[model samples]
Target: MSGDDSLRAVFARHRVRLLLAVVLLLLTMLAGVGLLGLSGGFLTAAALAGALGAGTTFNFFSPSAGIRALTFVRIVSRYFEKLVGHDATLRIARDLRVWFFRRALPLAPARLGGTRTGELLARLMSDIGEVDGLLVRAVGPLLALAGIALASIAVAAAIHWPAAVALLLLLLLIGIGVPLLAVHSGDAGEAERARHRTRLRTLAYEGLEGAADLAALDARDAWRARVDGAARQLAGDDHRRRGRLIAGNVLHSACAGLGLLAMLWLALSAFQDGRVTAPLAAALVFLTVALLEVAAGCGLAWQALQSARISAGRLQAIVEQPPSVSDPAHPRPVPASPATLSFEQVVFAWPGESRRVLDGIDLQIRPGERIAIGGDSGCGKTTLSALLLRLWDPQAGAVRWGGVDLREVAQDDWHRHVAWLPQGAPVFAGSIADNLRLGQPQADEARLWAVLEQVRLGDWARRQGGLSAWVGENGATMSAGQARRLAMARALLRDAPLMVLDEPTEGLDVDTAEALLVDMAAALGPRSLLMITHGHLPDGVVHRQYRLQRGRLLEVGGEAQG
Candidate 1:
């Protein structure tokens, strides 16, 4: 499907609200036009009556009452137009953000690994904001003006057909022609501005996040210069687009002036020929003027339209990328009974490379066993864990749980059976209980403490005021060892059958690391374990050890005895 197809679907979801906003906008503009036209006719007729010395016989109450009623309609419609339009815009913004996360999440790490976090944020925030304001900014104004133009032409026709014809020609030229020109000339500028804006946001976000590193490395000035360059480029593009918008407005005004003069000539000619009254001629000119004023906004409306399309396309591009791994068409349920995990004859390599990262790999972890694999950097240690996690399928052979190939079951199902602790596991800002509950949301207070003690953080928790104590953002309130144990407690709390810990003691001292493993080794009842780390483990941490060298697994300890 095309990039905009998803946008069309989202717009369709909120169609009713958008349509109501358009109707309200139309009412406001049309009522304003009608009020002005009626006022013009009443004052003109009143003056004429006075000129003819017949003022006492003229009735002013009906025209004046009509003007008051139209005035009230205009006021009320304008209020609701803003209200309903703003409401729809806000709702669209909320849905677009939710939609972005829903679609972009599934492609994480696999398809979107190459994309920067800041660039993705730019799309989610900046680009989506552009699309989210569509109803109030672009669609409503254009439709309301179109409605006024049509209604004014019809009213003029009822009074004088020739004047109606003149107004119609002018409305077409100014209304359609001006916006079309703005859209045509400003399309490229809008796209460029959006690109530069995204770049600027990305640069600023990255710079702020890495500010300390930038200063420490003495590269702060370089990053700041890049950010400033992006900002200047964005400003230049904005200036150009504004210039185009001004030119379109100028053309619209010229056309509007010519339209008024032509309408005046037709109205006067028809009045002289007795085709219409003097008040009617004046009212037609006033109506034409009002319609032209509304039509003048068409340039901005079309410009907004072009910008929204560009932003929508950018948001859609991220959502449209195909994931490297996907669930099978027919997935078999992962077995609930305890089973063995095995990789048989597995061979794999990184994409776009002929060198194999893993070759002729065969291994098995029986129920209730702990296995440790250590290797030099880039020896496919992490790749082996990733295969078990089923992030990517091996190019050859199969990974199986309970004799069922990993690819045979859904990825989510497999994930439910194994808990993982990545190296740089995040410590979110929340109470100790809150962070613990992330692994198992419904975990009770008792279970929270139990897991905390298992990872040797129970004493730390009590000292800090128990589970309710607030953890600062990114564990700023805690030491590296404390955060690592917190992550370990979270992982240990899961009800999964197998656990994978990638350097669970990362950033911790030897004493703390050994203490954590000693606690975990005793607390682990029957679940299997796979650890990828270079650290020396305390005895009983694992039942077996293997060192992977040059893409081959060599058992260094605990070789199975048949």
Candidate 2:
């Protein structure tokens, strides 16, 4: 879907609230116009009546009552206007964030490889914030301005046709033409401004995140220069936008002045021709001044609309991007038989790369089989795991489960049947139990401690106040081995039929890595295990060993006891 369509759909979800907000805004504007007109007419009529003495009379009670009524309407409507408008905008802001997150999740790691973390953060915070103004600052104001302009024109027409024509011309030029011209001239610049803003945010966040490493490598100065460059670009873009806004504001003020002059000329001519009374002429003048607020609002609303369009486009780029791997149109049911994973003459390559990461190769592991595949660094061991997980489809042949092609089954269904532990699996900033609960949210404390014990983290958990203790940011408080094991514990708790452990013992000493492997073996109960490692696996833990070389899996050891 396009950005505008997506934004419309999001707003449609809360259309009632937004509609109410706009209506309230319209009422508020109308009240302001009415209050001004009534006050001017009442004061003018009272002055004329007093000057005429006993020769003329005026009804003070009626005009005074009208003035009081309008004053009450203005106050109440303005209050509700702000209350409802802000509520709608804030709600849409929250909903848009959630919507973007839901849309972006399936496209991660593969399709989003080129997207930076800081850029996405900018979209989530800044872009969404700008778009949130679509309801209040743009849509609501435009709607209210249109309504008030029509009402003001009709009131002017009641006094005289020339006055109405003058009001109509003013609304058309100042309210519509000026804003349209401003937006058309500034759209591209606004979009570019948003881009540079995102870039600056990305650079700033990256600098902060890597500050320690950059300092250690003596590259902090260079990183600072890059950030400064991005900031300068952002400032230039912002300055351009501000200049456009200032120009639009100046044009609007000029139009409003000309509009008021035209109205005054028309009102005076009508009063001399006896078509309008002195009080009515005064009312027309005051109404024209009040309606200028609507004109000013139109100019600001158009500027906001341009900014919102840019932000919407940014959000749309990520949420509407097609996933690298998509589910089948007519998905086959996941096979219920004991799971067996097989690679049948598979060939694959990364996008834009000439050489294949995996060649035509075939392998199979039945239920209860524990196989270890080792290879030198960069031999595509991790790529093999990615293919099996359906992160990307094989360019040729197929990875199958129980003789069914992986592509033939739903991705979620296939994932449910396998537990994957990739290298550098993240430990989120939460309690130990919170991290483990990701595997099984409903798991009790007993199960959590059991898995922790299996991964040899039970003692550490106890010392750290058990599952409730905070793990710090990304498990910072834990040792590298402990963090790795925490990730393993999460995977172990999943209890899937197929388990793929990629470098599970990475960063551990030989004895420690081997011991972890033994513990992993004891924990495996009738499940298929594919252990991809760069180092040695524990002796007798695998039924077979294959070394990946030149994109082919070659058996390097005889069948051994598990």
Candidate 3:
């Protein structure tokens, strides 16, 4: 489904609350009209009774009681309407963010890597907000507005037909025509405002993320200028959009005044001609007033609808992009046994490039074997691991697990057979245990401590108050070497047959890196290890070493010393 359809699906999940909000809004609007019309008629009747010497057949108590009832209904219904509507909108926003992640997370590095972080974030944070609030703030209220307009016209006709005709024409103009004008004039402005907003967010995000680089290069001033310019453009678009909105308000107000005068003229004529009582004629006028006042909000609601549509389309564009790779039509499961991984004559290139990154690559890792592959940056060592991980299929060959082609196996099941430690693995804002659980959610404390000890972080965890201690965002509280070890420990926690570690010893001192590899090699009991790095390894860490350069892998001599 398209993103717009998905957005509607999110709203549909809260349909009961949305419908209730509409009903409450309708009741609130109807009560307002009823209150005013009732008051107007009662006042006219009382004045007439006053001139008739105060002994007339006027039931003042009943009209007074009705006025109080409508007043209470309006206040209570509107309060609950706001409460339910806002609650539902918040729920939808929460669901939408989750849905966005579910769809976009799989595309990471392969598809979404080309996208700007700020632009992607703008869609998640800004665009989704526009869609999530539409049902509550605009669609429901507009529906209720229509309901009240129809009911008001019916009441006007019952009192006097000509007045109803006049009221209907004016109500249509106020409800439909004014909103159309607002949307027509403001469409371009709305789109421009959205672009400027996204641009501003992108600039702000880049400026902050690259603040250190900008400061070092003396370019912070230029980045700030770009942000300010984007902000000014956003502000300008907003001003123009609101200016169009004011035009709609003015048009509605004019129709309202004209509707009031027309109703009054018709009502007074009918009463003089003995067609309606003074009280009923007065009610018709007040009813027109109440309905038009409510209808005055239609322009803003319509504008919101247009803005939400633009935002939804933006969200849809991203969510609907085809993944670089897809699962097979009939994916088979990996065999539940000790699996041997092999790359057979694999040829590969990036998505939009002609140059091969892995050209006719071939390797094998038997169960419980330790193998290390080393290469310079951009030499496709990581690409080799990626193929084994099934992030992308080889253009010309097959990656096999226990003689079953990796493409034949479902990605999730294949992933379960291998544990990955990517170069840029994240340490999320969580406890050490929480971070470790990503690799092994059901791992016991003893196991967690064991893996931490394996990665040379056990003593550090103990000093930091144990597993439950807070780790700052992106492991901000820890040094680079500590965070790197934490990520390694996470991968180590997974009980997979194959472990792929890309530059595993990164950010550690020379002694620490070699020592960590030694412990990792010792800890590998019957598990095959494929470690990728350009750094020198301690002797006896791996059974063999291979070199990758210019898209070819060849058996190499010794460690690549830093």
Candidate 4:
């Protein structure tokens, strides 16, 4: 999507709250100007009286009451404006995060494989920080400044046309012209900031991933140097941007000073010619300077606009990425009963690779059959299973379920009916029950225990506080074997008709692996199983075995072994 389109979408989502905030902000600005005008009138009235008469006849109560009331309104309006605007900005930030995450979900294990954990975290968090200024700093201030400028010009014109014209010209020069100049002048600084961000992200991710290695090798100094270098680059970029911002501010101040001088000259000329009263002239001059605050506010808001533009471009890139796998327009329902799986001359390849991973592979398995696929690493065993799960569509041929192409079924439906235990299953930082609940959100304690029993983890779980036991970050507090077994329990709890096991026992002890396999076969009786294994199969378990070699699947003994 284009940058403007993306920003419009964000605005559409936030427009209602933004409009309310802007309206309140305009009211606040109006009240502030009224307060300033009344105070100036009060001062001029006090100045006009002779010493004894000023002390006795100055109508202090009237102007004091008006000033007090207007000040109260301004304060209240300002408070609500900030409250509503900041709340709305936070809401937009949350929605953008959800939108980005949902869009990136289906592209995982392939599209997301190359991204580091730290970098992705930064994008989801820090990138959103940059975009927050769009609503918080840019929108409300610009709207308020526009209102103040127009109102000030109208008031000035009613008093003297020359003062009004000068004020408008100065506002245009500072608020519009200088900002455009700053944007052009700061382009190099912005580019440098982008580069600095990339370097920081890369270094942060590398340091996180290599923390253990760096500690072991006493290389903390080297990593610190790299981090410091990235930080210095970011600092330098910020310094340049600030320099440009200061230049813009200086230009704005100069224009405001010139406008004030013109307003003073016009007021004095009108006073000398007896075309205006002294109090009127004084009010116009004071109001003219007060309105300069509006111009400076707009200048600061413009910088926020520039930052938002940069962040919007980055966010748009992710949102506009097309999904590699999307549901069909007219999705077919998955079969109610368990169904046979068929791969007919299926061919597949990695995203950017020229060579296909699976070439002309044809296979069929009856319902409730247990099929074991054995192969060396990178020989298409996992690729075939991923295709069955519809992670990616085959470049040639089709994978069918119950005589219907898998692609015809809704993606959600297909996933719902099949449970996949991927290699090194992720263990979130939560209790054991929390981890298991991902597979079966509604599973009760009894049901959880049953699945744990099936996975041979029931006794162990009962000893570890049942389902409430904490599993530390990435299951770090648990051994590799325990984490794997916990993942197995989760898959068992899913209770889907088909189970795809990918290296389920890779890191388990021989006894533990055999026990898991035995229990899995018993629990999954009469359920279709497509298991990927690199070890010797248990005796009297798998009904058939297929070996993948050089991207081709071959029967073990020239017969269906079932």
**Per-model TM against the reference:** 0.94, 0.94, 0.92, 0.91
Give lDDT tens digits, candidate 4, residues 1-562: 4344454676687788989999988888888877777788678877776544735566779889988998899999999989998899888887778767766776776567666666666667666777776776886788777888898889889987877888788778877888777767564566568657867987888898788899999998999998999999898888878887888888878877887888889888998999887767888888876777656766567877777667666666655666667798999999876788899989898888988899888888788898899989999998898899898899999999899998898888999989899988889999999999999999999998888887777888888888899889889778777788889888878888888999989878887788778777888867789999987778766888889887788787864322
- Count backbone clashes in candidate 1: 0
- Clashes per candidate, residues 3 or more apart or on different chains: 0, 0, 0, 0
**Alpha-carbon local distance difference test for all models:** 0.87, 0.87, 0.86, 0.81
Off by over 4 Å in 3: 1-5, 507-512, 557-562
Candidate 2 regions off by >4 Å? 1-5, 376-378, 507-512, 557-562
Error of 1 at 398 (Å): 1.1
How far out, in Å, is residue 319 in model 1?
Answer: 1.1
TM value for model 1 = 0.94
Instruction: List ranges where model 4 is wrong by over 4 Å.
Output: 1-10, 51-62, 185-188, 191-195, 213-221, 507-515, 557-562
**Evaluation by TM-score, superior candidate among 2 and 3:** 2
Per-residue lDDT value at 505 in model 1 = 81
Which of candidates 3 and 4 is the stronger one according to lDDT? 3
When superposed on Cα atoms, how far off is each prediction in RMSD? 2.9, 3.0, 3.3, 3.4
User: Candidate 2, which ten residues in sequence have the lowest lDDT sum?
Assistant: 553-562
TM-score of 4: 0.91
- Best candidate, TM-score-wise? 2
Ranking of candidates on TM-score, top first: 2, 1, 3, 4
Error of 2 at 205 (Å): 2.3
